[model samples]
Target: MRKIIVIGSMSIDLVVSSSKRPEKGETILGDNFFTTPGGKGANQAVAAARLGEQVYLVGRIGDDDFGKEIYENLKDNNVLVDGVEPVTQMPSGTAHITIADQDNSIIVVPSANNEVTIEYVKKHLEQLDSGDIVLLQQEIPSETVAFAIEYCDRNGMISILNPAPYREVSNQVIESATYITPNETESNAMFKGNMEDALQAYPKKLIVTMGDKGAIYHDGNRKVTVDGYKREVKDTTGAGDTFNGAFAVGLQKEYDIEKAIAFANLAASHSVTGMGAQGGMPTLLDLEGEWHV
Candidate 1:
């Protein structure tokens, strides 16, 4: 079995929901407040693990209660945490999220996540080999992301780069990554608003995820759009992470691009029907009847 290695951040989420967004300098009542284990990297790890993949999460957490909870959550989800460690004296990473109108806005404090340095990754890199499925996100240092992509290329590993939270991506990184997944906004920013051109430029390599509508990728022959499964929306926080994780599993199963995206779409649709990012993630058994693979 190919190992799924996720190099990213781990954090706790402080979430609040309201019917409307607060204007500047104004305070408003909210519907609910909660905390859950989340972070782009952790969410994807859990998502993949829930789908029955043996996922290894590599990142840093703080030596705090929140960090302990995050660690426990990963273990509960069956994600291997050999690469996850706590940084003494540092605060655990956190995302303060506000949900309004079924959508969300988040403010992240990368605390200990910033400790995922190149040196740290090098210490763990020796364990990886060719054919491993390495999933990554932009929650860690930018240099680490670039190095990992290049390393995967050199080692013959497959790398899926999820550029979230909007960072300025470099051309070399884009070219080096085996797969680059970004949402509509992030894709536009990545390619200077030339989505069609960008898709054509990297057929089969660039996947743009659109919420609810679906995701699209160029097939080298033509543009293929995988329609998303419709589900009642509760919270959309980890829907994209769910998609990335499920997509990685799909690839591990040797499914074609279309099938993989379809599988991811189904999983993402299920993800939004619940509250926390990992709350509604479906197990492989949950996908029995609907998932073709």
Candidate 2:
């Protein structure tokens, strides 16, 4: 079995439904509101652990009610949470999300997440190995991400970066990754909306996920595109996270990148059929049935 380590954010999300996104200085009535434990990092960690991977999560949350909720959620999902810390002065990271039918907007305030430093990740580096899969997202500091990826590289562990809420990461960091999974928006943004614009220097493979359109792979030399599964999407909150999680499982199973993305694509399609981020992910059986892989 492959050991998987995920380093990122663990946050509580407050979601509200409205007919339209509110404008500045405008008050809009909402239909309903709900709270869920979510953070791209935490969601992927849970998704991987539930799929039978040996998983570890490194993140930070406020030393408050939300932190307890996050900790319990990870434990209940069988994810190792020893590396998750509680920041006393900082509030737990949280999101205020607004959903209007198909479109959604989010405002994330990184409180405790802002406090998770490279030192925090360095302390947890002892558990890694060449057989392990290390995953890091951008919810925390870029420096921490650099440290984790560098440590994984030196330790011979394969590192995968899911550049969700995409931000600029160093080319050196990108090159260090075994793989970088970016959704369409992130990819386009990272590439400055020029698909023809080549970023040939990255040493690792690149996966660009286009919702409904499917995923494309550039693994150093060849380029392959995997068509996506079709489903009536209820909410797409955690679809990308599901894709990355399932992809990690595929890598652990030694499936090649193309096969892994296909598996992950199917899993992501399953996730959008329901509501919530981690709430809607498919199991291994679900992926098998949906993709017939």
Span of ten consecutive residues with least summed lDDT in model 2: 195-204
Q: What lDDT does model 2 reach? A: 0.82
| TM-score of candidate 1 to 2 decimals | 0.98
The estimated TM-scores of all candidates read: 0.98, 0.94
**lDDT to native, each model:** 0.92, 0.82
Candidate 1 lDDT, tens digit per residue, 170-251? 8899989999999999999989999999999999999999988999999999999999878999999999999999999988
For candidate 2, write residues 170-247 as lDDT tens digits.
878877888888877787787777643443434237788887778887666656678998898777888888888888
